[model samples]
Target: MARMATHMITGAGSGIGAAVARRLHERGDELVLLARDAGRAKELAGAFPGARTLVGDLANPDRLSWAFSHQPLPDRIDSLVHSAGVVDLGPVGELTTRAWRGQLEVNLIAPAELTRLFLPQLRTARGHVVFVNSGAGLNAHAEWSAYAASKHGLKALADSLRAEEHGNGVRVTSVYPGRTASPMQAKVHSQEGKEYDASRWIDPESVATAILASIDLPRDAEVNDLTVRPGH
Candidate 1:
């Protein structure tokens, strides 16, 4: 028997989000890919027939709410993956309020709001939620205060949601990936050091595989948190 499911993925235009979308599509899952760039979203949606695309800025609550309100909520959502994030590298003292707020809005607030909006559908399906957090959420580093703070908040939110949703048939997984080979990482390394080899970094495909493992686990068992790092 073919298993049918609906999945919504943010940041699905690239990186781990794109890999996860492809993997889920290959497994015969229906997908709704959301990204700020309509062109990129359209390109990805074309790769999977019947898959849908929604373009909106995560940091814009009105845009997000409008998009969700206009679209018919799925009867059930087997999975919701929050992968959209922004990283700003600067000394804490030099960071502006606007930068801090932007980071929080994109990394923390958007995911929380989106989850709340989709809670009913997730409840109906007993779905899983995945947060693509960073190792920065677990450990601190200089020159990344804003990004780290947002990720830490994200981690806390995911942990709290997991505890609250226990036995309610909703599983939450926080993925702390260390130095993934993504465009975001490239930007980070460009300012830091070329010593950070993309080849030595964790592959988005591998991270997506781990996510799939969590999603496919037996209903009675849940993988709460997973950390994926490249072999050093």
Candidate 2:
């Protein structure tokens, strides 16, 4: 029998990450979820029994290496999925440096650091890395300056990693989903002062399907980028 695949995921507490975790858990795969604290770690452990949790605050990317040195990392990881992100909307003229730093830390730098830390295990397993970027990664709107910049940087990271890791048998994919119905979306709507309507957007599960498809493809082929838009 083929060995069960293991996936390490961030942002599995809600949204697309939760959907992906549920699907993988149901399929009898091993999961390692990243949490910001012991309490969040406990919550993830409870949510997905038998899955492991690692505590490392994404807000402090510089400390992840130090944090992981003190924790037990999975011996093998078939995929490392980056689905955690934060967004605050404001015009460039009004946005604070703190706001810019917050989004950059969580959305861009955290994923990059996590990938660097896990590259050894990932290369050993010939694993895949999936970045759950946003449509803003492709286009920056008025108030989305900071968030978009981070995601745009994420795209460059994925692209560069793919080029560098291809010979190592490590696949890199970026999934750009447009306005998914997630807590992040709700928060974005709140910031925009718009009424929240979950039904109008793509479902988290739909995006999860795209992510899993990229991960599950045969070793002979790889998906470089995937874009999911609301069907309605």
Candidate 3:
């Protein structure tokens, strides 16, 4: 039998994570879906035969470590997609330490820890690491201090990792996708008159397609940073 490509995807419960999981599943890749919610993880696993699920809050290092240690380790991880993130929008003065830390934990720290833990497997597979970052990382906006800071940190982390792994054959691609149609956005724009047309936002499937394209590129070709936005 042919060997299946192993993939670990964070935030696989919904949004771009789920879309990417589906895309890989269609290609016969074995998936490990990690999320905070067990029910959602099980639901996604049910949709894709042989796709395993890991339920844990990535913000907690103990939880993340325990899950991976107990679960079956993949022979090699062909792709590591960091789509998990949290957005807490508020004026700088109103942003509490707890809230800011929470955003950083999920958006930046967790992914970094995961990358550190799985670096060996990725190196063995000559795999690609994909960071689903945001345009906010490049451009700051009012009332988005925490979110912007976390994304900026993530972008820096990804860039630095790419440079460090230049000769190791592990490629890192930071994708800055603007305004996706996800529950996160709905929560962000829930206030009156700030309603966003989720239908008009970028499709998660399209982002998934782009991710797959990057991964499928020849080893000699690398797309370090890809920016995508809705065409509206």
Estimate TM-scores for all models. 0.94, 0.99, 0.94
For model 1, name the residue pairs that clash.
none
Candidate 2: tens digits of C-alpha lDDT, residues 110-212: 9999999999999999999999999999999999999999999999999999999999999999999999999999999999999999999999999999999
lDDT of every model, 2 decimals: 0.87, 0.97, 0.87
Worst 10 residues of 3 by lDDT: 187-196
Q: List candidate 2 stretches off by more than 4 Å.
A: none
> Of 1 and 2, which scores higher on lDDT?
2
Question: At residue 181, what lDDT does model 2 achieve?
Answer: 94
Choose the strongest candidate by TM-score: 2
Give lDDT tens digits, candidate 1, residues 174-219.
9999999998899898767665677888899999999999999999
Question: Which regions of candidate 3 fall more than 4 Å away from where they truly are?
Answer: 191-193
